[model samples]
Target: MNRVKRLIKSVPGSTWAGILLMVFFAFAAKGYLSERNIMNILQSTSALVVLAAGMTMVILLGEIDMSVGGVLTIAATVTGMYLKLYETITVANIMIALLICCAIGVAFGLLNGLLIGYMRFNFWLVTFGTMSMGFGLAKGVTGGGVLSGFDTMFRWISTGRVFGIRTCIIWAAIICAIVIFVNYKTKFGLHIYAIGDSEICAQNSGVNVKKTRFFAYVLSGLMAGLAAVLLLARTNSAGATLGEGYEFNAIAAVVIGGTAMDGGKGGFKGTIFGAIFISAMKNGLQLVGLSNYWQQVLLGVVILAIILYDVINSKIRDKKSLRRVYSDGI
Candidate 1:
C-alpha cells in the first residue's frame, strides 16, 4: 500500500490525465494503437518534445516565448536552403546555423528577460512583442514564401529508421536525457526551482534573479535550435509559415504535462510525456477522421481544459497550504 501510494504521488494527476487521454484516443481509433502507428506518433513527437524541453525551462521561470515557431521556421528554411544548394549538408554549416538560431533566441530572450527581469515589464507583453517581430523576420527571410527540397542526409534525420525507431526520436531521447540531468543534477537547476518557487524569496536568499532568468531564456533558445534541426529534416521542407502555431502547441504540451504555467514546479520528464501524449492525441484524432480544422479546435479545447485544471488545482493547493498553516498556529 505504501509503495502504491508513493507511486501515485510521484505521478502527478496531469501526467496520468494525459496518459488517459492517449488511451482514450487510442481506443477510439484502434488503428492508432497499432505498433506502426505508435511508431509514427513517436516520430512526430520527437521534435515537439525537444521544443517542450526548452519551453519547460522558460516556463519554470515563469516566462513564455511565442517566437519559437518563427525561430523554427527560420532555422528550417536556412537549413533547407543549404542542403538544396549543395548536395551535401556539412557539419560546419549545421553548427553555424544552430549557433545563429541559438544566438537569435538568446538575444531575443535576453531582450525579453531584461524587460521582465530588470525593467519590471511584463513577461507576456515582451514575449508577445518579440513573437510578432520574429514572425516578421521569418517572412522577411523567406521573402514571404516557403522553401522545400532536402538532401538525403537531411531527410534521413527525420524519416530514417534504425532499430525500428526514427533517428530524430533517438536524438530527442538523448536531448531529453541531458535536460533531465541538467534539471536534476545541477546548481542551475536548483536556481531554476528557487526562482520559480518564489522570486522574492529566491532573491532574498541571494539568488541572482536576473541571471537565473537569463539562463532560463538561454536554455529556451538552445532547445529551439535543437528542435529546428530535427523538425526541418523530418518534414523535408521549410517556409516562412512552416512552424505556425507551434509555440502554442508546445505550451499546451508543457501545461498538459503538469508543469505549472505560473512556474516554480515541474521538470522535463513530465513535459516529455506531455509531448508524446500530445503527439498521440493528434495522430489518433487523424485516424478517427477528424478534419484538420476540427483537430485544431480540439487542441484549443484541450489547452483550455488544461489551463482550467491548473487553476483549480492551484487554488485547492493554496487552500490546503493555508489550512495547514492555520492548524500549525502560523
Candidate 2:
C-alpha cells in the first residue's frame, strides 16, 4: 500500500488526467476500445508524435521553434519536386530524395541554432523569420502547386502494415523511443535539463549551454524532416500547405502532456501519453458526432484547463517545499 502510494505520488498529475480521459472515452464513445479504432488513432497520430517529440526537447531547453511546420512543408516540396523530375522509381532514387529532405531540414535547423545560440538573437523572432522563408521557398518551388507521383515503395513506407500495425506508427514509436532514451540516459540529455533549469548555473558547472541549445534545434529540425517524409508518403502529394498548423498542434500536444512551458521539468513518458490523449480526444469527439470546429474548441478548452492545473500544482508544490524548509529549520 505504501509502495502504491509512493508510485502514485511519483507520477505527474497530467499522466493521471490522461488515464482518466482514456477511461472516460472508453465508456462514453461507442467502439472506442475496438482494435481497429485504436490502430486508426495511432496511425493518425504518428506524424504529430514525431513532431511533438522534437518540440518536447526544444521546450525542455527553454526555447521554442515555430518553423517546424514550414520546414516540413519545404522539405516535402523539395522531395516531391525531386521525384517529379526523376520520374523513375528506384530504391536509390527514393533514398536520395529522403536524404535531400533531411539535409534541407538539418540546414535550416543549423541556421536557427547558429543565430539563436551564437548571436543571442530572440528565439521567437528568429524562428518566425525562418518560418516565413521556408513557406516562401516551398511556394516558389512548387509554384503554388501540388507535387505527386511518388514511387510505390516510398508510399509503402507510410501506408504498409507490419504485423497489423501501420508502418508510420512503427516509425514514430522507434523515434519516440530513441528520444526518450536520449532524454533520460545520455549526458547531452542531462545537460539539456540543466541548461533549461538555469543556464548560468549550467555554464558555471562546465556545461556547454549554447551548444546544447543549438543541438536541440537541430534535433527538432531532423524530426520535422523525417515527419515530412512520412506525411508525404501517406498523402502521396505535397503542397504549400502540407504542414499548415502542425507546429501549433505539436506545441499543444507537448504542453498537454504536462511539460512546463518554462522548461526543465517534464519527461517523454508524459508526452507520449499526451500525444495519445489528444488523438483519442479528437477521435472520440468525432465519434460522438461533434463537428471539427467544435472539436477544436474543446481542445482549446482542454489546453487552458491543463495550464490552469499546472499552475495550481506548482503553487502547491512550492508551498509544501516552504513548509518542509520551515520544519527543518525549527
Candidate 3:
C-alpha cells in the first residue's frame, strides 16, 4: 500500500491525463489505431521530445530558454556547412561540428543564466534578449540564405530506420532514457527540484543553485543542437529560418506533459508522453482533413487550457501543504 501510494503521488494527474486524452482522440479518429501510425507519431515527435526533455531541466530551475529554437537553426547550419565543405564527413568531423554548435549554444545559455540566475534579472527578459541575439547570429552565419541538400549519411539520423523503427525515434527513446535516469536517479536532479521549489531555501540547504541553473540552460541548448541535426537530416535542408516556432511547441509539450512552468515539479516521462500526445493531436487532426490553421489554433487552445488547469492545481497543492503543516503543529 505504501509503495502504491508513493507511486501514485509521484506521477501526478496532469502529467498522464493529457496523454489519456490524446489516446482517446486517436482511437476516435480511426476504427483501430494502426502500427504505422503509432510509429509515425513517435517519429514525428522525436525532435520535439528531445527539445522538451532539455527544456524540462531548464524550466525545473525556474528558468526559461526562448533561444532554443534559434540555437537549433545555428547547430543545423554548422553541421550543414561541414557537410558542404567536406565531400564526406568523417565521424570526427560530425562530432566536432556538433560540439561547436553545442558550445555556441552553451555560451548563449550561460549568458542567460548569468544575467538571470546571479544578476537577478527576470527570466523572461534575459531569454527574450538572448533569443533575438541567437537568431541574429544564425542569420549572419548563413548570410541570410537557405542551405539545402545535406549528405546521405547525415540524413540517415533523421530519415532512416533501425530494426523497423525510425532512427529519430530510437534517438528520442535514448534521450528519454538518459533524461529519466538523470532526473530520477541522480543528485543533480534533486537540486533542480530544490532550487525550483525555493532558491533561498535551497541555497541555505547547500544546493548549488547557480550551477544547477547554468547546467540546465546548457542542457537545453545542447538539446536544441541535437534537434537541429534531426530537422536538417529529415528535410535535407538547412535554412536560416528553420525552427522559427519551435520554442512554443517545445514549451507546450513540457507544459502538457505536466511540468510546472513555475518550476519545482515534473519529470521527463510526462514530457515524453506529452510530446507524443501533441504530435498525435496534430496528426490525427490532419487525418480528419483539418487545415493547418485550425490545427495550430486548436493545439494552442488545448495547451492553454491545460496550462490554466496546471496553475490551479499548483495552487490547490500549495494550500494543502499549508494545511498539512498547520495540522501537524496543532
Ranking by TM-score: 2, 1, 3
Model 2: which residue pairs collide?
none
lDDT of 2 by residue, 1-330 (tens): 989976875566666767887898888899999999999899878888888888898899888999999999999999988888765678888899889889988988999999988788999999999888888899998899988878888888899999988899999999988999998999989998998899899999999988998998998899889999889998899989999888888888888887888889886777787888888888989988899999989888887787787788778878989999999999
lDDT of 1 by residue, 1-330 (tens): 989976765555566667778778767887777888988888899889888888898888877877677666666666566556665677766566566655765676677667776777777777787777777777887788777776666567667888988898899889999999998788888888889889989999999888878777767767776788888878877777777888988998888778887788888788887888778778888998899898899878877876676677667778978999999995
Q: After TM-score superposition, what is the CA distance of residue 2 in candidate 2 from its true location, in Å?
A: 11
RMSD values for the candidates in order, in angstroms, are 3.0, 2.2, 3.5
Off-target runs (Cα >4 Å) in candidate 3 are: 1-24, 27-32, 313-330
Residue 212, candidate 2: C-alpha displacement in angstroms: 1.2
Question: Which lDDT tens digits does candidate 3 get at residues 210-239?
Answer: 788877877787788778777778778886
What is the clash count of model 2? 0
Q: Point to the candidate with the largest TM-score.
A: 2
Worst 10 residues of 1 by lDDT: 93-102
RMSD of 2: 2.2
